[model samples]
Target: MEFFGMNKRKIIAIADPYSTGHHLSYNKLLVEAARRNDFKVVYISDRIGCKYINEIFPDTDIFINEIGISNSKISREVKKIVFYIRAFQYCRRRDIACLHIAYIDRSIFSIALANSAIKIDKLLITLHWNYFSSPENNSLINRLETKIFSWLSRGSVNTNVHSGLIVDDLYIHNIKSKYTPYPIAVLPSITSHEENKLSCDGEIDALVTLIRKADVSLLCFGGMRYDKGADLAVHLLESLPEYTHLFIVGKPEYFSKEYLNNLAMSLGVESRMHVYDQYIADDDIQSIFNACSIVCLPYRESFSGQSGPLTIAASLGKPILASNNRFIAFEINNQSIGEVFDSLSFHEVNRAFIKALEKSYSPKEFIEKHDPERFIESIGEMYKVNND
Candidate 1:
């Protein structure tokens, strides 16, 4: 008969499911993948409820909730702690085998609350940040994180990292993880309906058609802010006449409107640049990709985290000219990914912009190389093999 027969895994995916962003999409993929292998799955998110614990109670042999968390106010923290404690009680009610918390804030506190609920043999925490690498980070946060990891080691939550660079740094810092120094998986962000909305009429259509036809040489995305390379985007666009339009999307700049208008006037590319100071809906994001000849993210060096937005552009197979910092640059080098450029100097950004306009890369090949199936399969099994 079968030596290793099918196993049952119960996974509780906890994240800020408020938007159709990376975290939520990852959960969906996990559950679906589990189903393919005859494994029971449950997705839990807080994006929908105020329930100290609300549960989706999946149709499978598992349970999940899209959990929302609160760390904003004093009362909110107290209420959240109490709510999380109640969540442990709820997990007990349904027999949650392994809980995977997505965001840092959610994971840290959730682990604290689920202390008694977790069995050392089954506990895991995925490391999504390099607390040591942060520029102005307070020592207190790092200290506490270190202490938390030490505590988590008994159960030893696997720190699934996406890069070998992070793995080495964590080890150098004496932090612990369970998988390869690199993250175990790389699930590129997907636009829920990014394609459908791109084809819609009105403002979105006009902008897309105009930009695509004109085929602008340089386009900078992310918010039009200094940190996100707003000024650099403008500076580079002005430096190169071939670089036509810079599609400035995401949250508005410091002001409502005039900052961008003024920035354009200052750069003298006001007429060439088009700014949409609004949140690009998940379904409508493809327009951002389709409208630009190349996507650029000139992020300043910091220990913030991975660039989900930049990664999104890369996955779609567009030519992405990105900051040449450690995380972004390493991603390009290790994965054979995109066009990595020096973000510190405007001259470098200008040169990279020009190069991107003339280049095209295999988006499909990038995905093939990253190969999300292993990542997806393991997560799926994580839920299926655990006994509730």
Candidate 2:
């Protein structure tokens, strides 16, 4: 059913304190999706995210800390602590129909603390992953965090997760979750298929400069964490054809540029790679996507959340070369968008890379079953379930 006469109902989206530039894109999409469904969104985020969102979504209601501090772990946490106190106050003064927390782990303590002070009709938490199978994920700190978040979730109307596997995992732990697919972050402006083609001579020099030089531009976007397989992408370059160039984009989280370069040099493929070890600007995101023949996501099993890069790639109609993680595998097979390799086997990775390079195509359709509209509708259903 269409959402109508619900414009006054408040849906607040509290962003993750540690959200990076890449994540803000999807966060904006979330706000837009909610507004499109006739609900007014009260977007609460860090100063950086607020600025970015203001530029993209000026009409939405927004609130951020006044200090406007720099992006750092301590600063973000401090800002969020302040934001949460203010948020609870705002909710207390007004009847908020629902509260949606992004990066829910970061705000669990705040929510738990506020629960005794105030109550709301519906509470929704986005659990990126609950990797109960991984021993590393069961450390004392992680365990404590999980218990707190799980306990808070027990009171929530619905816990949102990216894949059914995650829902099943949460089920084993007795916390029910809803499978909400990650939304398409970037919507192509051009509807005609012919207009979407990337011209080799486009004026986007930063991207074109590299795309024009290589036969295949293999893009690895987002944080350069070891779990993200940046090194694996570099390792593939050691034996890849000289025509293929690996572009590892995003800020270095764990892997340093000097280390990556040295490894590439030792493998004798340093000349065929470009490592932009900084946060990519928003406009440059599409440039990088346009310049590449295909997107690569060799993420390790350690990563259990949805792949934002995969969503972005699908949005731009670019093919993906992903690992065999259940979510990635399901998306690749479900949409016929790309090929999946055995993440553990370099041999399979190489084969998938070759296949991706040999053919470039887009998915037949978006994962409509889990698209944003349906996601909002699901949340609406949950709201009704709780309010009834």
Candidate 3:
């Protein structure tokens, strides 16, 4: 697995908080990139995430550790302090040349603390959101955290973000960052042991059948949250043509399938709506996306990060109908991939969805520009141990 003549410096470690959702695919892509760049990677995540990584790359070394904090204010602060102490110690003991944190939103302050004390050769962080978007985010405590994070970035620490808008925002604050493409979640060619569990799940076939029966099926894929606007998707169904259907795939975070169904029932579109409230396997992603006419993303204004479902939809050549979030709108408009509308306006979204259905999209050019190899190479450059 070693690349000949590749710089054999100290190992590069990647730390991620969560194991589920886009984390699994993102971590896999990162590990592959590190290996390709000739860096020995020590993957660190929770026990479940570690096991999943092991199953994917059995030969690669991995470390099982909890990297996320609790939700409670007091408990979260306490856990962050402990995590910072332990992280610094682990890097010192392992002689880690570079420590790249995959997601630093929740643990930014703790990571800032660790950066000050850790003696690693280099540190890398992926800034996923624009924290300075609101006055609340600029509160005294948050400003302090941002200052520390930016100060550290000028040293051995390198920072990157998936959105160009985030990069620009960081630049405005005198923080330099690289714009890395969000890695496409390539479904595995060979089904994994976990995916095999869903082989006999009748829900997959039922959903596919339901979508195929419709004239035009709208899909809201990936983890469901109130911010993601599943309620808006339901509302759109009521105004669309009678033949239009909606399929919601992925696990719900703060709501239940019954709640969404009830909303659809209230809108009198219950007969045309379908819900699959569970984690979908890699094998099923293609079939599900293929069944849908358009991918809907009506995320609220509070959501400032890139959408995993948007990436998936674009890669699959499925046209998107996304909210006018800075990143999502940029991608759709820049690439001519689909249509965009303000998430707050029900009438706008309704009109935009119909327009998307009628318009033809040629995402092949967009797909070619942001392929997985390009994303991997960008990350590999960031993971370079000898950046001097």
Candidate 4:
């Protein structure tokens, strides 16, 4: 816990257990940067996150255990309470100068830690998605949780918000938090395991086959949700030329095959539509990006955060056609990295589609400005400013 008699500038990234490969990639970039900056980097995460960190960074110090948390409604509350207690005790055991957590949502652990009696020099919590900004997230339970969280967040100096829009929303609700956009991490290379293609046997084969057969592909990646514009994507794909195919990947939640098939059948474009309702492999990320002519992100207006898919698309230099959501619109204006559609109008969407085909933008400048090292350094500067 201490180097010699003095406590080192120890930083621990409290990586969330239930997160995407994107988070793992971000963590690897972060800690590596921290290590280069002469800080002892520690990672505290659940079993899955720990295994991934080990595989990625073999010699990193990681504290891993079962958080016993589930998304299931039956025992979510009980599990979260238990996890919070354990997380508190775990942090108390370590001599952490700064505790950095990313992608905070409904979790109360960050707020609790920041306000706890533990003598942490600083606790930084990065919020990925902002629930209060999403119009559709107005259920009684969600509202109640937001109200409670926002109330507690006002008194905490640890929270880092990713969107200017979310920051404004939080301010209106009296929850003061810092606005810090997510940094663009480096794209992962094709690993030996990935290059082997041993796991390409079943579903992936079918996916690759479908993608290969298409003359032009429009990728609607990420999980299917109402906010993600799955229905709109299906409809747009239906309206496209016969040679164009829509590759709808990722597990379906609010969107379903039955609904999409029925829509496709009705639109008489079922033959041109190929849907793989499963999670895509991390190694095949470049393949997916390459296979598609355009990456579509027609998310609803309610989305108010830095989009990982958008960042990845930019990182890979893929052309993007995204709806004019708050953050996406801001990025489009700031970087000219993508074309935006008027999400309110179908006619405008069709025009945007045509525009994307003829348009291109370089992500080179954007990518350079937010590279991992540059980004982590900015965070270090901010931490210094806050501590000072």
Residue 192, model 4, lDDT: 17
- Cα lDDT tens digits for candidate 4, 51-82: 88777777666777465746786576566555
Candidate 1: tens digits of C-alpha lDDT, residues 317-349? 677777766777777666655677764465766
Judging by lDDT, tell me the better candidate of 2 and 4: 4
On lDDT, the candidate that comes out on top is 3
Q: Candidate 1 regions off by >4 Å?
A: 1-17, 47-83, 105-110, 113-121, 131-138, 180-201, 213-219, 222-227, 252-262, 343-346, 381-388
Per-candidate TM equals 0.76, 0.80, 0.86, 0.84
Compared with the true structure, what per-residue lDDT tens digits does model 2 show for residues 36-92?
A: 655666666667777877777676666674535548877766666666666666654
Between 1 and 3, whose lDDT is larger?
Answer: 3
Candidate order by decreasing lDDT: 3, 4, 2, 1
Which scores better on TM-score, 2 or 3? Answer: 3
Candidate 2: stretches off by over 4 Å: 1-19, 51-59, 66-80, 116-118, 131-136, 177-204, 343-346, 367-388
Residue 67 in candidate 2 has what lDDT? 34
Q: How many clashes in candidate 1? A: 26
1 against 4, candidate with superior TM-score: 4
